[model samples]
Target: MNAPHTPASVGATQRRRWWLAGAALLALAIDVASKSAAAAWLPGRPVELLGGLHLRLTRNPGAAFSIGTDFTPVFTIVAVAVIAGIVWYARNVTHRGWAAALGLIAGGAAGNLVDRLFRAPSVGHGHVVDFLYLDWWPTFNLADSFLICGVAVAVLLSMRNVPITAAPSTEGDAVHLADITGGRDGR
Candidate 1:
């Protein structure tokens, strides 16, 4: 049976939507702008600043640390799947934290995917623009930052046992939100 909506659930849904939209747009914008700036300013040679930080432009045709250098097309496909999965799962996001985390991941995926689709070489095989080298770490970009932060937030959320879906309703005769979304924890 379909359960009627309540004020609280409606508010939660609205909040989730706002959080997801805001986080995704902001992250995507920042990532794109940063990549553009890095490509333009840090092309010729590495620029050191803030003691140990270095800005170096690099084009990565692989995953993190330049792994899978021959699989740009595969990575492009994976990015699409990830973005779709996040959008599908976001309907059950009852917490702002989850929304923001998902948004960060989505934004990062899109940022990289854009490069893969339209940057150079060919469609689905373009290299990703990377910069922001620190010490001996691999050169990375804002997209990587967003992705890493999103994953860290996901781990923290899981460790806290916080429910990603709404809690059970107080009423006695209605189906629970948990039932509609998935299991009790919204996985």
Candidate 2:
């Protein structure tokens, strides 16, 4: 049996949705701005930074280190699906951490999707703008950073057994692991 949502609970869920949207917009804005700056300023003039980091601009027609270069349109489609999934899942989020995590993921995906839809080469097949670089790693952008960090947060929350919605057993108190995983054995 499912418990009916109270007015307070509904309000909380709405707040979580706002958090998700805010985080996504913030991440998307930063990514788009940074990419534009990189495209405008970092061509043929790499700048070295601390810790072996460099500001170098490159356009990638593929996903992650130029892999699957032939599947740019597929990537765009996947990104759109992922963003939609995040928005759908966020509707029931009652946890602030989960809201932020989903928001960042959606924002990052949208950031790259913008590039795929509008940047360089052709529409729906444009290259992603990558600028930040390290000698040992493929060049990445702010969107990638947001995606990585968001996933990391989500993993941590899952490992801790954080509940997405309020559990009836907790009665507005802190959620416990058993309330989420059933027991230590996860059964």
lDDT of each: 0.80, 0.85
Q: What clash pairs does model 1 have?
A: none
Cα misplacement distance, residue 178 of candidate 1 (Å):
24
Please identify model 2 stretches exceeding 4 Å from their true place. 167-187
Clashing pairs in model 2? none
Estimate TM-scores for all models. Answer: 0.84, 0.87
Candidate 2 RMSD computed on C-alpha atoms after optimal superposition onto the true structure:
4.2
Q: Candidate 1 residues 32-128, lDDT tens each?
A: 9999998888899889889789888999998755668899999999999999998888777767767777899888888888889989999999999
Evaluated at residue 78, the lDDT of candidate 2 is: 91
- Top candidate, metric lDDT: 2
lDDT, model 2, position 133: 93
- Model 2 lDDT tens row, 1-187: 7668899778888988889999999999999999999999999999999998999999988876667888999999999999999988887898877788889999999999999999878888999999999989988899988988889878877877777774333355334445434474466
Q: What overall lDDT, based on C-alpha atoms, would model 1 receive against the true structure? A: 0.80
